[model samples]
Target: MQQESYSQDANISPNNYQLSTPTKEKKQNKTNQSTTIQSPNNNDFYSPKNVNPWKTPKSLLKSNQKQTTPDHSQQASPYGDRYIPLNVSRNLFNKQIQPFEIEEENAYEELLSENVLEIDENKHSSILNFNKQKPEKLQTNKQLENPKRKIDTLPIKVLDAPGLDDDFYQDILHWGKNNLIAIGLQRSVYLYSVDTSKVFQLTQRFNNQVNQIQYTSLQWNANGQILAMGSYDGQLKLWDYNKNAYTGTMNMSSKRISTISWANSNIFAYGSKDKTIHICDIRVPTYSVFQLHGHTQEVCGVTFDGNELQLASGGNDNRVFIWQLRGGNTYADSQYVSWEIKSHKAAIRALAWNPNSSGILATGGGNQDKTIKIHSSLTNTEINSVNCDSQVCKLRFSKIINELVSTHGYEKNQICLWQYPTMKKIHQLEGHSERVLYLSASPDESTILTGSGDETLKFWKIFPSQISNNMSSLLTMCEIR
Candidate 1:
């Protein structure tokens, strides 16, 4: 009745509203509209169960906590079960997550919970061994070799020589192989024994002569039985210290015999101021066997090689000559002069042949030059040279090592030890107060004797005594005079 009254009052059109819809149908349509309004469009909405598993779980949780409901909360309350917050769902969908961290944590936990296998130590000891090996130590040659130390700076023995000459060109002191020292004091030759510490005047008979000749040079033969004394009068006096007798005296030259060097037990050579070199044999006590003339000034230095096969001579004429031993008249006109060197600017006096090397010679220059030159006589070439800084008075090769010991004069009256081939100076000794004029080594070459104008004879231990058996045998076989 109420529906008919409202239709008549509004001038109801019965054709348009043919039949009234049911109340149940109208309520169903109203519920559908409310559901559509509460839920968002399908394109913008997402379900929690269908969310990407790769997204960071912490971001999704934070977005969900930050999300707020709209002011129409009561309207959407009935369909809240099917609805999801747009911010939370969109953040979880848009974000990227690192899967490795989660996987690593899972793997570590799995490893900690895993069960490890066990084995009996005695049953598999060899296969499960963990011992380390210890290596053996090695020894070096330096550790096994002899213990050698540096030489002392002071002389082991010092002696007084009241009348020793200070002349640079003359050699007046020599050490014989028998351990005796033959030293000339002014006009007399004295013999000093190393063992007994005794001195004897060998030229006692010459004390009576009015015109006593001064000793210029002294050398002992290879046998160590005869001592040859050179004088300013050109006399080559021979003496035997063991017998205390004068063996003989030969007139070798007209001027002073400045230096003498023995070649063998019976043969020797001497240089004189007459600028000549003479080789003599003991059998002919009055004459020389071979004569050599090359120097224009006084011959001050002469030495035979290691094997006594060749002779090297240095002269005041600044010349050096190497001669080969040959018998006169053996060949019709054969020359004994093998080579000559004029490398020195001043007089050349100091000369020494390397006892260990063949054809190796060391020559030193005088005050004007002040240099040491090494030469190879085999190749006829100058090997090396060094400035001595002072006058080179004498040079001698060391027997225990391949070295050269030199004495200096003028300024810096000192002795120097040089390493051979390289010509490097090793040590310098300064005990002399004046010019050092003489140098002679002991029989073993472990010690050297030096004489200076200060009237003192000093002994220095220059070489080591730890000599090899081969070197000892060689020294015994060769004279080294």
Candidate 2:
């Protein structure tokens, strides 16, 4: 009856409703019972009351993705549509799978924790028990600041030494302990007083021309009372400084004296172009007291050891000879050649004896060799050698520091300082435009005088003696603190 009543409407049709048989009604009731079964409050089941028909489907949402399209104005002029697939799958996968981390320790922190843990624990324990150990005010141990010992290589004073002969083999400059400097200029020898800063002519040529009577060597006695000068005319002259007068003259058998070194108060040794080393006693200037004959070429350099019993000589024959003195007044027969060094490849002109180490001797070679060799007298063996990279003109050992100084001749014209025994170069003094021919150190071991072939004399404060006082004061202040 209800289906016939609903079918009477124009919109309702009898075909839309089926007559309810007993089995159909029971099946329909069973379907209604299953549909009416309540589900638990979970989002997995789709309920008609909660479902929105107006919402977009998941498939439609996937199809309509928010794409980042390039602007048409920035595209190429052609109008063909191009779709480029993003190649960021690996990056996306990596970002999605990567695990999150908090923080990590660096290598230094790990090393400290592994090795210094015990020390750190001990330090912490000490700090915790510090109050119990001492009740005094907290204080830190002050560090002593040592003043740096610096070499001021700049010339403190530069003076024009006119008419100075540019001879590498000649020793024409000497600085005395009395703050006096005697330099040979042409045929005249000039004396300079460092205290008064005054220079005066000590001697001049009497008959010979300036070129023929050039002074080749100058030396001061240990007491600074007398000065000895050797001339190219094969003559050696003595001057009394206090008296300011020429005392005596000795003739060398037509041989030019290249270098001179004082052995004692009354005795001095000189090297000659005749390949001979002669020792002269001022009391007897008529003849040499002793003569050393080892070199086969011109003897260019000579030095007396600290004890004055050993003499080192270098010559143009690339040889170095060490002679032993008889300690007292003796003739040529008493002195003998102790050793001969044949290590140099060229002429050997520079020689020096370490004042601190009595047995150590240093010799430098000429332009062809450019090498400096150190020999031990006791061992009679070569101890060390250094390649100067230039002609070595002169070598001097420091009295206060365990170091050595050298002047170069060709190419470099530099003065270099080196550590003793090790021979490590400490500093290089550079200023002279020409080859440095002569070098002298002050008696106080604080200043150095250099003479170059450019006819100039430069005074350099190479060592600071006041640094010792500053260092001592710093140590005392630290101790007091």
Candidate 3:
């Protein structure tokens, strides 16, 4: 037989060679073995001739993986790692978990303080578990428990104050340190006892005088023993209420004395319609110690600072002046006039000095101006101002808090409580049928009394009481006894 095309090596065995013609399957196996030999790796079935030149190595690898891996598209999870729809999540959460029970809308808004939902994906179905959490308390509700809460909007007490003057330019009401309130009603001055709730006349009505003497202003000494009354007939009268005796009466001005203030228990100051301020020592009833001339019209208001070193005066000329209390006879010296403010468009009838702050003064304008201005006597400039939208009749500062209470006239006839520096209106009280013209605070500063032209006096509890534990216990002990 013809020798087969075998290796011409001496190591070849004749039994391993196919001596006859190769079968069809054997021929195909030879072709496949020849294609595999073209590649560098004998285990790699992909050869250069079998793979397309345009296809990358990554494509060939993916084709091989697809042929080996089984398809699981028909058996996939219903949930996914991505976010579920809001509606579907809500339904699932409602069915799986119970939410917190909130009593208020604010509490509901603060509910679910944390995202406590935890998912377990090891099981066939997704399970969401919610943990319980405490909702935070509302700030507004906690603030209501404060000791210094908001004041009541209504008055605690009311009384008829008939014959009270309706003038917006006069200060006819004052509360003394002895718990006594003095109010000028036309030609008479009456004292009301806060403890006894009794009313007594301080001055009798005089019918024999040529011109009827109507009481214009009232003020009390620091000791609350002597009260100073100004009259329309230009007279200044002092009375010792404890003794029920008249101290003295003198003609301090030729015009009506519209206002009066005490620097101490002895040194006194009064303003008149003659456009002058008279500062005199009560010890000497003969003459005034100093005469201040600044305003061109009636001097309707006058106040002394807490230290008795400066005096503030306002008038119908729309001018406010701060005078230094030096040994001087007149403020015309120019050096004695510490500050002069003409920021008001109408007459200024209200003036007050901050009891806690020296050189800080507050002045209120009349009907046409309807504004309150705060001034610094030390800097000789206006510190702040607020438009009241109504006639500012009077102003009183709280001794315990940094608050200012103002009485209004002409339309609304309301009383407003304002926070100092910021000048924010804290509360507004309305009860008077006519213009609210007079304002005064109790000795403890826990209450304020407002006198209106409608002949009504309303008492409002404006500040919290500052009572010590010992005092409260003593009061309780006395009540029990």
Candidate 4:
């Protein structure tokens, strides 16, 4: 028997193998000539099951139908059960595989290039069509025209408030609607008439000097006929300026009264060191109508709303309380506190209600907090806050303008005027030698008066009077004659 050996080299030609019978060669030649190579459709080219092992797929052929080298690496068994080694048949497959030429257009690149060309054309066209011209000069006459009036921050009057206590918690000065300014100086209360420019002593006190019974707070009724004064002896005295006589006196629980606010013509509220607020009626001075008890420390500031139906009080406990005055037959059953706010980190002493808007209140904190908070009385929610950068000692809203004025201590030691709603600062008045402890507005809100520990009372002509064009003119014509 003869044994045949297969060559290990893949470059061996077909003739190197033993030749088959002449009849099989003729059949192979006929089959090779008659066979037509059909181009593969998308489905057949992507489907592995449609591939034929005996012949190269149409995807690997050229359009000219040229003869290609036999790829031994791609040649599989007749039954498609096995593949040839790639390393041994690399050269043969390299010659048969042609680099595919992609004639399909890239839609994305075409769209992007079109957009870029259009932008370039538009930009070039705009530049080409643009006309350059010299700018016209503004007329000198138009530039010189001014429409707004100028206001000066100078003080209209400065007077000596002798023996004025340099206390931060006590409110000793107030301006009445009848153009009367009352100030507590030691044991004496003096009334200065803005109309006459005359000062008169309203009361004399012998025990006030010996017992150190200094007046702490002063407030006038709505009609400006009755003046209420609170003394260090915990006594609230009402005096009639017309009659020049004391009308009544009510004793409070605390020895010192810090603040007093007139709720109405007949009712007034006073805050005391006893950490309570007493709402007393001048008609019935024997007993208070109602007593508010929420503050853990001394109540320093108290205010009434425009309608006199609501009251707000601030204390050294860093808390603010709002009370509703219910209309009923009995005083105790008529009023109750609505809400309590504990937002300040320091003592709260300055409080004011907006006269122009309902349910809006402003509160100021002491030296530590140095912030002013605006609140909504209806919902008991804080609307806004401003860091004044100094201790706020007093807050007053203007009746003639939509502005709020605040007196600050420590670093600033000045008065600031802020526009309402927007809270934008309009101006700052800096004339006080020390921290301003009291703030009051004139009857028409055209002037603001500030008292400081410097023991001097200064008046700021803040709002422009409608009757006069400037502050100097108004002061000369109205007060100075």
Stretches > 4 Å off in candidate 4 = 1-149, 207-209, 285-287, 327-335, 466-481
- Model 1 error, position 386 (Å): 0.5
**Model 3 agreement with the true structure over 162-181: per-residue lDDT tens digits:** 88878865778999999999
lDDT for predicted candidate 1 compared with the true structure:
0.79
Q: Which segments of candidate 3 are over 4 A away from where they belong?
A: 1-148, 206-211, 285-287, 327-333, 467-481
TM agreement with the true structure for every prediction: 0.67, 0.65, 0.67, 0.65
TM-score of 2: 0.65
> Roughly what TM-score does model 4 have, to 2 decimal places?
0.65
Give the 10-residue window scoring lowest on summed lDDT in candidate 2: 36-45
Q: What is the C-alpha RMSD of each candidate to the true structure, in Å?
A: 21.6, 23.0, 16.4, 17.9
- C-alpha lDDT score of every prediction, in listed order: 0.79, 0.78, 0.78, 0.79
How big is the positional error of residue 290 in model 3, measured in Å on the Cα after superposition?
1.7
For candidate 4, write residues 153-191 as lDDT tens digits.
778899998788879879989999889999998688999
Looking at model 4, which ten-residue stretch has the lowest summed lDDT? Answer: 36-45
Clashes of each: 0, 0, 0, 0
lDDT of 4 at 324: 86
